[model samples]
Target: MSLLSGLPLQFSIDVSSLLNVVWLGSIFVFFIYGQRLQMYLIANDISRALNRLKIMRDKSRKEAIDYFTSSGKVTGDPTQRIDEFLDYVTIMPVDMDPRGVVEKVQHITNTRDERVRAEVSQIIPNLDPTKVSVAENILEIATSLNQIHKIVRHYYLLGKKTNSYMLLFQLQMIMPMVLQEADALVNAVDTFKLGQPVGDGIGPVIASRYMQNLPKQVVGKDTVMTVGEYKGRTLYVLKAEGPMGYVGEPGVAIQKLIEEMKVPLNAIIMVDAALKLEGEKTGEIAEGVGAAIGGIGVDKFKIEEVSSTHKIPVYAILVKQSILEAITVMRKEIAEASDKVQVLINRVIEEKTKEGDKVLLAGIGNTLGVGQ
Candidate 1:
């Protein structure tokens, strides 16, 4: 035993020397290929995000196809037809001259809207108008998700192919926010499918509440108006006709009320949901001046142009919420904000317009799952 033990510790290692060698090897490897390793890591992250986006995009597309086929309205498989609609693109009007550009933009956008509506209607001819609106909304969401996925994939493949760290870095940085948006849109698909009121419906909800028991007439395309007296002032309240997903032609409605209908208005009061900052409360209320509408600037431009021509004072009451909350199902807090908005509207009207004055009240936003 003693002789065997003395034969020596052949496996013994110098701990300090071993650690130094390992540390040096690691440093050497990283020093030579650090950028490559980082690029691989970043690409891996982006690949994962890209996969998620594809899933979301495909899910919404399937939802749209299912919605149409299950309606029993179409005779054949509508997958190809629906796919064509998803890939449809609208070329924006050239803005070089910047003169009469608004009208040009408006015309182009209106045409696009009509075309989209007609295509959807043709596909599901027997579906109710309300249900058709829902299908359109779902398709719109799907289109958006598709666009996002394509864009992400394009950048990812390009970045990897070219080994562009800057490109990859930029894309990686934005992926989180992009994914959040895609997720929100995915959630909105369910909300639209169910035809439930969303946070954006807050504006129409307030208008409908005030419009109770009042006679409303069609003012514009899918838009309605009701006349009522509040605090000794004639209040003309208008909102997008609903219980379906429709923003209607709110700008057109307001313009018609003033210019075509010859309603001499002392003041214009607008209420809409506004995107809130990160720290802001969900149902926070803010009052401002201007056209309180959100869209492709067609509606806002119309309102601004007309109100300026008449020198009418425009006031805005906004209910703040996040972008996700705006499109998804209506939150309890947002629903409660409607009551507060009504009170705020009263105060604005009373303070801005004198007794015996006429004021146009435009509640602007998508009117989904909300009534006239």
Candidate 2:
């Protein structure tokens, strides 16, 4: 009774009002806290996802060290290109489709190619023919890094359209992971001094090996293709020649070989690197019928155009690998896959061609680490 008497008069007579006040206050507090809790949870999830991506990027970086060392090509630190390359990224319009966008990319690539060649020539007067490949790789690595930054930044800006703070924050957190990937890619490419194979080089590797000990003829301004006998078939093999900077004008070379060289091709076989599925093994080779090439489709179009006119059956042999495997230092598995692919090519020729038939076999892709 003494303690109760010390309380305010309102506590004595306003019991229902006080209880109502407390109940409303509790609801308001919970509403604010619930929103805050949800924000934190979402933020936490985004952080976790970004962290996983970073881990994958880090693993890729570690693998790159070995790739560079084994290739025996990279000399100086090529990593400096990656940082300066960011300024070169093209800001693509959000409304544009990717199909048309690569045209601009090709233009950018060509410019870089010219710039790199000139720089290399200037640095080492009467440059060693072998060093040309290294220069090309440096320029290509710069372009690739720039493209990555362009892609990530483009999307990050697009996300800003929503005007959501949380969304922007999520994208911001993921940027470093992408940059890390760019760094890894640049280092690996600098190490290899060849365009990352990206499954595209398989065809060239096979073609070069097949053409071994055969006479190589200059088929185009920059193309070195071979005409030789393989398994009782007269094989006209075309690929971008290398060991000096070259991925040859394959599209132009193929068109000329059929329409101009008039080889009387019985069958047209294209071997190239193919993108593997998520669960697919790296360096797995598959045989089938189709173009089996990945690029701006210029080469594929020319091949199809000439083959269609001549009524030749086009066959495909695809070497499977992930984008990473294809573009980074040439992996041993991929190198092994090349030998296996040659066996398959021989089998394909035997099954598809008759004795003395003139056949045109094209190893289509960048022939950086390959030769005629």
Candidate 3:
């Protein structure tokens, strides 16, 4: 105290004692309320994220409603009906027995698709098939956003009611990823509304270009095929009948080509967009062995089944991108990678099969705004 007194007037009164008291006070306060403080901070973060998600969901829903009313013939306000439609749910087929579950799932999926299409058509009776497809996609994006917001809000309220810091913390951790997907879907709504090509369309883009000037015909439900020759190998190029927002049924098409049509194939070469890891670069290409399709496990299961049964080796060329990139507008890097994919496909065929062999070249992904 004497030394402090010599230093300055403000430091003259019991400096050491004051320091000890302040340290003890802070420790005592934190010891009693540290957990509460942490919970409060985490809850604040979750609340902010929850608000953002709500805004996105609401905005998407409004956009969908407006699109339906303006573009389609509607009597009175369609808001109520659209809201009801947004709540549509799909009940998955039970997989306990694990036999014929795939067919059941496919049936349910087909029925759901038909229902959605019919509803959209009813809402906008004036829209052509292409516009109807676009409208269906818009409604789907809104529904997805709506579901995501509800799920997050449920968890947040439940955690708050229970005063469970662990539960809140878990929600906080996943919020960023959840937001990322939500944001991507929001962008997709606009892209789809305008009928623009998406990153998911890269596969079809590659196929279309490779099969340029060749005559194409319907090979499967909403799927198409063309015959071409690549380096003395007979190429059976298959893709979704495009210039529409359709993924078509690549698995069914592949099976039909090999099984139904009895196109003797040496190997199957698939090209599709793949989701990239956090540290990975977008538009990077990788070659692998398998069906490179993404969707409900139905399509993937069918492809694997047919390929295995017929003993046809399947090769995949993947163009890696983020989930955001895959749904939103196609990036320049991804668009440029299509050229590289073609070259890789040629190499796979040359190395995997003989000169006179038939190879099924399948480009698997959505064909939105991509011409056949």
Candidate 4:
């Protein structure tokens, strides 16, 4: 009382207590405000990046459509032109933290705002069974894997303990199986073998006894026969019939076809099965001139030299899959050859055949007996 004699009784509280309260309140306010600022910055950056990506994608799409419909006739080789468009589109800087984006979108979805949810769903790629049943199945498996990952992360966060050893051992065993399953799924998605049912109507025409009996020779198990009618056009379609690693061997058949068929060097198109990325929808096609066919020594080197020397336009159509699972993912640059190529995705070969399309269909992969 003597120390606070000059002040009112209410103002004679402990100086230390008063200072402590003031300091704590200031810190609390600062922390709350700082957190809000950080969230704002992150949201703004994500929004900007997404908007930029959309602009680039739309621009590329328009360019492609314009080129296709500009002239009454499809000119300048559709395959080459499509490839060029894809190269321009993929060059856009759209990659961000996929997980963070997913989380942000999911939060919006939970708000039950129909418009917002619908917009977010487009970016997320709906896991509807009708669109892609396999993708839906994989999503279910991913959910289980996510749970397992969480348990492992929790154990890791805790300091070394008795159960830690058991957890580590279990994680080690589970990882390989998870990886194997992922690989299998990616392979299944990448290697799209459209069933023979779709090929029924067209197959009879292409496989009629008259066409089958044409001048043909079994060039090392692969029947090389002349079919289509193109005067002075000796079209040789090289269908790889070997193991996965033997894509280069087909080049030999190709060289022989060039020499025997005497086909114009510029009219050649090398078709092969290619692995696509997760974002690439199945049946999406593009055309590019790239050396995707793998092999060592003479097989690969020779093809490159020959194609280059002839100044012939080479085109490729790659199927999409996960890069983590398949090392042979299709190259984006392959789509930027000349302005004459077109790479069509998610294309049904059977459907293409019905349209009277004379395509050099190259099933690029380890062709170890049909269903790989």
TM-score of each: 0.93, 0.69, 0.93, 0.34
lDDT of each: 0.90, 0.66, 0.89, 0.37
Score residue 293 of candidate 1 by CA lDDT.
95
Q: List ranges where model 1 is wrong by over 4 Å.
A: 1-18
- Tell me the lDDT of candidate 2: 0.66
Better of 1 and 3 by lDDT: 1
Model 1 residue pairs with clashes: none
Question: lDDT tens digits, residues 103-183, model 3?
Answer: 999999999999999888777786777788888889899999999999999999999999999999999999999999999
- Which stretches in model 2 have alpha-carbon errors above 4 Å? 1-112, 154-162, 165-184, 193-200
Ranking, TM-score, top scorer first: 1, 3, 2, 4
Candidate 2 lDDT over residue span 83-180, tens digit each: 34324444443435665544565555556656666644544445455555655455555556545545554554454455455665666677656655
Q: Single out the weakest 10-residue window by summed lDDT for candidate 1.
A: 6-15
Model 4 alpha-carbon miss at residue 112, Å: 59
Q: Count the backbone clashes (under 3 Å) in each candidate.
A: 0, 6, 0, 33
Q: What does the lDDT read for residue 33 in candidate 1?
A: 94
Model 3 TM? 0.93
- TM-score-best of 1 and 2: 1
Best-matching candidate per lDDT: 1
- lDDT-based ranking, best first? 1, 3, 2, 4
